[model samples]
Target: MQIPLSQPDITQKEIDAVTEVMTSGTLSIGSRILEFEQKVAAICQRRYAVGVSSGTAGLHAAMVAAGIGPGDEVITTPFSFVASANCILYVGAKPVFVDINTKTLNIDTTLVEAAITPRTKAIVAVEAFGHPGGMVEIEQIARRNELILIEDCCEGFGGFAGDRPIGSFGRAGVFGFYPNKQITTGEGGMIVTDDDRFADVCRALRNQGREGMAWLAHQRLGYNYRLSEIQAAIGSVQCDRLEEILENRRRVAQMYMTRLLDNRFLILPTITDDVHMSWFVFVVRLNDLFGPTERDEIIKGLRASGVGSNNYFPPIHLQPYIAGPYGFKEGDFPRCEFVAGRTLALPFYGKMTELQVDHVVAVLNEQLEKVQMVRKPRI
Candidate 1:
């Protein structure tokens, strides 16, 4: 009866892969990591992939490699996870927030070029909730503006925009392997690119800047962002089964759509016709009539019924730390804030059952009715 928000689909194959790595005793900077990287690069249709400790680490590395230093501005959406913008700050660059398209829930492409100043160095584009809308157009914008495009594909894997894979659209793209993701590597991530120099720079950065020039020689400041061999082993197995994993997730998403698509109180995610979603988390938004307070009550009610749920993201611009420093306030990006306020991420995993899906939808409907009753106008 306790339905958790997300579960990693780990099979015996993944367990065995990890066991093999443990038995080998080469836990760091070993063959497994290389194999994992190669598999990811292949899947993403990129020439290089550098494994890192986490997606945040990958993003920071990409920003550093792109030479995004102090006073440089990186345009990005306020709708994404904070790491997308925080990566800009990590490299001493300022994040320029753009409002999201209400339909796509991604940065509004039409406004991107207008946001570009001479100081703008890059665009950190995110594939929100595994939907790949406007990514191609964003890449085109970056190219015309001579800006580095860093695709934060952490929430999107095995998805495509037009004919190109999600990670292949940018100069460099990052993917996360958190337990709740499409695949799990315990805690790992990757930076993928076609540029050899950028790949080498990231490899050096991930390993304390030891560019194989000397084992102990430090060429520049770096971090211990390397992924462990054990994590890579699990990741490699997950990659081996990537297609199957994607299919299962797609099925789970379909089940949710079938049950909730017609509900007037909810606004389900909008995926473009050309893109095949890889369903990171099944998030549904309460209609505009219902604000955050009512959304919160439904979440509370869901939790009481043992059905897990959460707000997928709060507006990154509105986070006190970001807002206080950047002078951001309400109405700066109303679309992102509106969606952020009402989004509810439901229990989602590759192996989620139809019965579980039905139960969740039923509980959600009941909660919505209760809220509507309480907020009804005096008659």
Candidate 2:
């Protein structure tokens, strides 16, 4: 069986919702978008939500709403999807790379305070792999520094940091609805915030700077980042079944954990006591003995065996675009680079079966042994 890396858990309910929207003449900026935004806001425990074309768009809008512009600096981890850092760049601001906590794979809050400079305007904290680790600490640090906090909840839609929902800790938080996420709208996102003014700004930003249904009047420069009615209609249905979707994902995650927890060569995802995770991808790290080369070989072997696998992330700082311009070297963020080198993402989805999970584990174990034997030749 060829187990794919990720799949959307779509049902007839979502199809019916999409069909209803298609039948309706009004497609964009309609009631479906409004309803979807409301549902997302409620889920994040925020007063408002602005639907956008993608999570990247939501983050860019949040950065713009926060007045982050030229000469400003936004601190974020290097061990995340590039969008987290790219949003800072979209506004002509610099993104200061930080290392991640080895355990949670999120930004190391302990080091955040030290990264703050006078030019530091905001902290773009990403809930990496849907784990809300160190978010509370990051919030406290941001408050102390008087910096804006933008929570990248792109992978953390249904998670919590202690008693608070994932989006509530920041001035603005964004959720992505990519196919691989816990819930999907094909390609859409939501920006959530309690700040009324910020919400208005994001809403306008997503709709070509038109304020309050003014279609042609442009107040400021903006992008066409609006989420479509069809996407929102599907999203609304997904939101209605959010609990069921999250529970299904959690169940699949547990299955992986139960099967792989005893493996000596791998380090599984860590969930802190105070935080509730919304599992996005099941990523495991090869032990310190395994380097990027070995990890890549293992991934290759897994794929060769019909088990889907991939390196979850490569350090964003080391990417050619960022590294060359910013003068970032390999050792700039050791912890992040270390973790990025060995991290492996396995096939994960709400509907993934136990047999599939077992097959993936078996393939992974076989690959690990092969790499190990090659590294240490028989004497």
Candidate 3:
């Protein structure tokens, strides 16, 4: 009865693809990797895509390619995974974090322009929990300011904002393919962009800074961030099935929404009009009346009842590594702190059944009732 939080949807097609790669003599820097890149680029409607070891590596390469280096400032959201901000630090720059919108759980566009300064080199906009809310406006702001916009689409693979795809909006977008994502490659990422020069730089950076296919000619200092041919083979198959996977995830999200819509103690995710959501994880927030302690107790109760759940994200700015260096304290970004404290990521995946979804909802409500009882004033 124990339901895990997330699972990748792997079919026999992926198995065959990987097995074929195993038979092939060339395991790395092979045709499969090139095919994977082309598939990702076509999906994003971008001119180029570079497969990398991970999303973090792609982000680092993107910043470096953009010439964002020492003494520069990159505006980003504090509510995202730490890597969103850490990437800026990787390129020897500072991350100027703005608060997020409580509804979309993405960066607040209204606050973005004010955060920009002469030192600002880029804006790293993350589609938190796979929600793309202010991306278009953020892109506009970046263009107006002549700054680079790096869309961190790590949680948003098959998502779309209006007619444009998630990775097609920014100067360069990065997508992660961890086991829990919409599509997975075991461990890999893709860097999507229309700029050929940026694509070339990323390709070189991911392969030990080589200028071309030649392995020995080192052009610049770079890390070993190349995605393996075996991983690419799996990713290519996953790309082919992206639409089906996205539809299944959307159905699961709808199921959760239908059950939790009327619950007074919970707040569901926000989906804007004209945006096609790619549900990465089904995260719901406990209402303001309940705080973090109560939320944690509810999660504990669910786990005790053989249900799996987790806090999807802790505020990036509040992490010890950033807090000490950036002088960030409590109340710096109240909305982000507020949302982060109460988020509970329930079991979610493309293959999840209605029975399992119902069981999770039942468990969640039972635990919530217990917390409510304890909080009641015993007059």
- The models' CA-based lDDT, in order, is 0.92, 0.92, 0.92
Clashes of 2: 0
Clashing pairs in 2: none
TM-score of each: 0.98, 0.98, 0.98
Question: What is the Cα-based lDDT of residue 267 in candidate 3?
Answer: 93
**Candidate 2 Cα outliers beyond 4 Å, as residue runs:** none
The parts of candidate 1 lying over 4 Å away from their true place are: none
Model 3 weakest lDDT span, ten residues long: 370-379
Q: What is the lDDT of candidate 3?
A: 0.92
